[model samples]
Target: MKIATYNVNGVNGRLPVLLRWLDESAPDVVCLQELKAPQDKFPEEAIRNAGYNAIWHGQKSWNGVAILARGTDTEIKEVRRELPGDETDEHSRYLEAVVNGVLIGCLYLPNGNPAPGPKFDYKLSWFERLITHAAKLYTLDIPVVLTGDYNVMPTEQDVYKPERWLDDALFRPETRAAFQKLVAQGWTDALRKLYPDETIYTFWDYFRNAYGRNAGLRIDHFLLNPKLVGRLTTAGVDRHVRGWEKTSDHAPVWIQLKEK
Candidate 1:
């Protein structure tokens, strides 16, 4: 099965680009982030017409997440819609579902800018919550794919110019360490696992002709638990999608699993 993740930035604004990619790529399962729309505003019918069923967690003009399964025959049994350990935290940032026997967790982690502030602190707190929850998922002994826009460059290789982003929240030492802690729980970074030394990137800013200059960041990721690691056959980024008109800053990233 082909599973993919993309941060669409705004589902409504980027509908055309998304549909085009869906038609072209035809991934069996997709996890979308940054819908930036309220629950009532999600374009359910449009998505259905494109041959996919979706369950989404949306918020007003901000964070949101969704999981899509192609075709009516595909089962998308929802497990949860929010990360555990935070009752008052209302961000629509995490969504989980069981698709074709694999537990898929889609998330849009906080973009904690202006480090050393409330937002940054919230980012770290959120990371801790994620870490706690991920550890539990690790022990489930079922095939699991935790994929999304993590919003952090886990290593210097993930950022175009690592030194310039060291002070930034996404690349700060604390953020990277948190990501490493999560990975240390025996989750494999799918893309990195496939191309251990390649400079792969999944996101590029609109400013300063970043995309043209290839100044990109590999923030979006797919983490496969031990049970699913052997099935990881191939993975890649659809970088051309990022150049589409009115497209999202993030390109679609995907991994194909060999059928057992």
Candidate 2:
């Protein structure tokens, strides 16, 4: 089975580009973030016409997530729309489902920009909650994948210029530690496992021709549980997708697993 994740930026505005990628890649399952559309505004019919069934949680004009299972034959059994442990938090950033016999958790983790502020604090607190919840999922002992734009560059190698990002929320020491601790809970970062030394990036800022200069960061990820890691045949970022006209700043990051 091929599982992929992408931060679509805006599902409606980029529907054509997204549909094009779906037709070309044909991943068995996909985790999508940043729909930037309301629940009623989601282009469900368009996505359906492309031969995929989807479960989505939409918020107005910002933060949204979804999981898509390719083809009509697969039943997208939704597990939840919100991450546990945050009753007051209402961002539509997480969506979990069972697709093609695998448990997939799709998320758009907080970007936490403008460090040393309330947003940054919220980001850290959110990370802790995710860690706690992820621990519970790890104990399930099933084939599971947590895939999305985590928005954190977990290491120096994950960014194009480590020094420039030191003070940024996504590259702060604490942020990286939280991400590393999550991985320590038996979830393998699949892409890094496959290309340990390569400088792989899934996102590029639109400013200053960053994509053109290859200035990017590996913020998007596929974190697989031990059960799924054993089946990880290959993993990669569809970097060329970023170069497409009207594409999301994020390209698709994916992994192919052997069927159980």
Q: What root-mean-square deviation over C-alphas does model 2 reach?
A: 0.8
Q: Residue 47: error of model 1 in Å? A: 0.6
lDDT of 1 by residue, 1-260 (tens): 99999999999999999999999999999999999999999989999999999999999777999999999567799999999998999999999999989999999999999997999999999999999999999999789989999999989899998989979999999999999999999999999999999999999999999999999999999999999999999999999999999999999999999997
Q: Candidates' lDDT values, in order?
A: 0.95, 0.91
Candidate 1 local distance difference test against the native: 0.95
Best by lDDT: 1
User: With candidate 2 superimposed using the best TM-score fit, by how many Å does residue 137's alpha carbon deviate from the native?
Assistant: 0.3
| Per-model TM-score versus the true fold | 0.99, 0.98
Cα lDDT of model 2 by residue, 1-260, tens digit: 99999999999999999999999999989899999999889898998899999889999766999898898667999998998897999999899998877889998899888897999998888889889989998888678889898989989999998898989999998899999999999789998889999999999999999999999999998888888888999988899999999999999988999988
